[model samples]
Target: MSTSDWLFLILQFFAFSFLAIGGAMTVASDMHRVIVDDMGLLSNNEFVTAIALGKISPGPNVMFVAVLGYQVGGLFGALVLTLAIILPSTTLAYYVAKWGQFNQHRKWVVAIKAGFTPIVVGLLFSTGWIIVDGFHSMKAWILGTLVMLLVWRTRVHLLILIGLGAILGMLGIV
Candidate 1:
């Protein structure tokens, strides 16, 4: 790759890592902003579509890093952004683990967890909302509600629901 390509790759990698709060998936919203809004490399609709695809894949939602990288700068960009998306949170989780070991029984630790629980739940809810924004229709709502019920009531694998959704979409039912 050229020097500029390498530079952009490195920058994307670290930027993703820095945004790793409430887990790597939360970084999707920021990445959507970066790719669609700041970089003007993708439209808002494209951003949402890519995020849905990324979430449906077998890995973390941060897979959008690799997808965006591939679109922007080819294979090398994908590799760099994958690393970027992983490295920061891995480091933070490691440190957090270490800290937890040190402060295992601290009341402040319990308080901190209690404080962050709602924020984490809210982030997850927002992630779901952003992912489905492009699928606004009665059919989409019906399928989404069924999927939510499946997720809530049983041990059905998420991949199965995603696959069924894809099949339904192909049939123009979702």
Candidate 2:
């Protein structure tokens, strides 16, 4: 990539870093928007599959952006995507932590923390819908429901559920 291209990618990285409110979900959605919507780097199905793989992988799901970048523009793209997804959060977190400490006993701070609980839950539900909407069929619904129940009812490892889903997928059961 040229210097201009690198600069542009860096700017995009800053934009994503600043805009994402939550953690991985926010970064992942930002990546989806850039790669799928803006760049047209991958098809919708590919985008979803990439995200699923990212989630099941050992590390953070946001690393999927690097994979997409490598596919689209090799090493430079991967570097740009990583910088964009992570840098802002790391920098802002410092300020946020300081602010939280400064306002530790403030009533308004307490109220805001209380308010954020439901907002976070709502975002998580929306993320779930985004994932579930990609699956097409009654069977997918049945399996998803069973997995959801298992997650809710037991302390089962999430990887186990994800593995079962993958196996079912491979068997064409979903």
Candidate 3:
């Protein structure tokens, strides 16, 4: 990639950090739009694969941002994109923590916090939709729905589900 492309990618993620209300996962489709559809850096399969990689890895689900950077530009690209995406959030979180400490008892603050739950849930649903939509098969849809229901309604561990999904994919079951 050229210097301009790197600049654009970094700036886009910096802006996206502010818009990441429920976390970076919520802004995944927008990332997909910019990285895959708009910039044509990665194909749909590549983007979805990156999402899979991110999901299976430990820590924040946003690891795919780094995976994508590495895909596009190698190790340095991974470092740049990870820092670009996280720095804004990290700074905001620090100040928010300080403010939240003082306003923890405020009614409006409680109300705002309560209101965010639903919004975050909705955003996560949309992100799930985007990932599931990539695979155009009934089996994939069924598996996705079943997995989602299991996650939502049961005590099953996420890593187990991920492993099962990987096995199913390998067996061409999804």
Using TM-score, give the best candidate's number: 2
The alpha-carbon deviation from the true structure for residue 82 of candidate 2, after best TM-score superposition, in angstroms, is 0.5
7-36: candidate 3 lDDT, tens digit per residue: 999999998888997678779899999999
Instruction: Provide the lDDT at 156 for model 3.
Output: 100
* Deviation of model 1 at 68, angstroms: 3.1
TM-scores for every candidate against the unseen true structure: 0.72, 0.76, 0.67
Candidate maximizing lDDT: 3
The root-mean-square deviation over C-alpha atoms between each candidate and the true structure, in angstroms, is 3.7, 3.6, 4.0
Model 3: residues >4 Å from true position, as ranges? 1-13, 21-59, 68-74
* Candidate 2 C-alpha lDDT tens digits along 58-80: 78767777776676678987787
Weakest lDDT window of 10 consecutive positions for candidate 2 = 22-31
Clashes of 2: 1
The Cα RMSD in angstroms, rounded to one decimal, for candidate 2 relative to the true structure is 3.6
